[model samples]
Target: MDDQHLHDHRRLGRELGLFDTDPLMGAGLPYWLPDGAVVRHQLEEYVRELECSAGYRHVYSPVLGKRELYEISGHWAHYGDDMFPPMRLGGGGEEVVLRPSLCPHHALIYRSRSHSYRELPLRIAELGGMYRSELSGALGGLTRVRAIQLNDAHIFCTLDQAVEEARAALALIARAYADLGIRASRHRLSLPGDGAKYVADPALWRRATALLREVLDGSGIAYDAVEGEAAFYGPKIDVQIVDPAGREATLSTVQIDFHQPERFDLNYIGPDGAKHRPVMVHRSVVGSVERAVAQLVEQHGGAFPAWLAPVQLAVLPVSEAQERQAHDLAERARARGLRAEVAAEGSLGARIRAARLVPYQVVIGEREADAGLVAVRLRDGRRVDPLPSAELLHRVTARVGARGTELWADA
Candidate 1:
């Protein structure tokens, strides 16, 4: 089969019951099916764990903000075309709009309390929702959506620490991609070209651009420097990925900004007991959960690794005689936090074919059930010697816990 036919996420997603779009939901809005939700939830949890270990403090913020907030952040000036229009109460009351980005709110959070030099580097993270008024023609599947759940974080640190923070963020991104089996097509140093779209401060732009260059060079990662692709306020390092059609899109980013700190007047007390502005570093390990899942769906061709498979295991009974045993095994697997279900409505062969994409399938026949064992079938079509049900579950659980890419760690 051709590459596009084999790896198209839109087709694979629908066939696997991952996600679907409906007319009533509007264009650019797609609903996640149960299986898709499971995948998204797992990815979100993984990101939270990764960020927590790296000293990021997660927070919750409102999705809607006053119009004045975006205006202050310069989003209204530079990004108004892609933002949803403001909604207001009757008779010129308070007007609000869905936030196009989380940076403004995070900036507000930092300014909420005074900080000392010792706390100069404050890493704030959120699995937050934001909206964009995308054009109808630009919408397709989860790749381009109006509502986005972004795994976004912003770091407030001194100028001297910004490069190191950006580097750490890049390393975290690399770790996540390796675990997920996603690859970077390229690393792009996105700068602001001679365009009216960017904030017009030549000195600030030059400084931020130089800092991002330092980050990429220090990491020893080769990258292409592209112009006219930067954020309105600053330059960034964009980790790019290609789709099944060979179209390139950014999957992750690390950006450095001095503009937002000035706009929000964010400051921390220095060693001399004086207020000083802090630099803002924006980064995302996974840009959008929807897009990330889409990439995974194609990258793995809907046969995800053991830990990421929507249905990790299928328990099949040879006949009615072994049905009870199948249920017992499934229950034990679930109790151990595995995604498992008993498939007994059909012949064992038919059930096995149906669960081809599942990472593991265990069959219980009269002989196996009588011996309290299971006939294990790996997804790659390898058969393992019959083993005690308890032992099989133990090995599978350990493999899943470790997020091993191989079907069997020992193998």
Candidate 2:
């Protein structure tokens, strides 16, 4: 692997002050600066919009769960090693663990309600923070961290609806990747492994694998089959994307589980009046927010799209005499819902240079301010013709809503 690209990203991240890691505070934990937080908030908003449009209801669950909860979910036996050590409170008896996933909590929520066949498919989504203990050496900027914000969701559906739900999940992931400018190569279908490591039911594994393959084929998506990658309880499909460094990362995944419902005794009254277990599908469009942000930064070389740019426009006054106008123009831009700011304490050239370093779309100037307009400049250093304040507002607002790259285009 060439160190050039890797070093480039690390230098850019530090120079932009997006995030920082301090050994004293412990490794694998990143402290995000205000600029970094802005990027995250934009990502959260984007994911929320996607989930809402796909008919998933937003939900939240606690970060820590009791030890018994994990035992019942089979996480204690299967994923205990990946989890942070339990905290023993009140001396010794009770133990709590930071949640590694949201599936168990969502399952408990489903069990809390009694549902009929009419409500067979229930989808819940969350943008929640999750934690896992990682070796210090494994920690990197935003890509590999101990604490991460996950864009997670769970769907509980009848066997008859499982395939459709899976298709829907795939569609959601594809659309999200397109929006983020990520290109999908091929899907990876993870099936149950060998007899020793998997449930001793060959018939069931074969049936599930066949079902997943059928679904993938019918959806017209090319995929490769891989054994031993599925969760102990079920088969899964992972969307792989190649990063700037040519490494494949599982950007999103959808898993179908027929076993978890049985483990948790989750059932719904069927159309025929008998109680039956509903298949559970766990998915995430952008698997981990930290990794997603890192990918976005590298993909665009740190020049984010307008909607995701921490500061969409930077207002620069040519001299101190133009400060009031710069502030006024910034206020107007902000009122129009664009993230705009005035650079009041730097040389005009220095201010514009600094603004270009970040992912802002335009740099306003004194000449346009005198005409009640703002001069615009693209991040790539191209100058846009001056536009009236109202016109600029409308243009910026439109680009933001559409999440278009043309937002930085010359007027």
Off by over 4 Å in 1: none
lDDT of 1 by residue, 246-289 (tens): 98999999999999999999899999999999999999999999
Query: What is the alpha-carbon lDDT of model 1 when measured against the actual structure?
Result: 0.93
Candidate 2 lDDT, 173-255, residue by residue in tens: 88888777767767999887675445555666666677677778889999998877887667789888676667776778988
- The model with the greatest lDDT is 1
RMSD of each: 1.2, 2.5
lDDT for every model? 0.93, 0.79
Pull out the clashing pairs in model 2: none
Q: What is candidate 2's local distance difference test score? A: 0.79
For candidate 1, the clash count comes to: 0
For model 2, the stretches where C-alpha displacement exceeds 4 angstroms are 1-9, 194-197, 344-346, 357-367, 408-411
Q: Which of the numbered candidates is closest to the native, going by highest TM-score?
A: 1
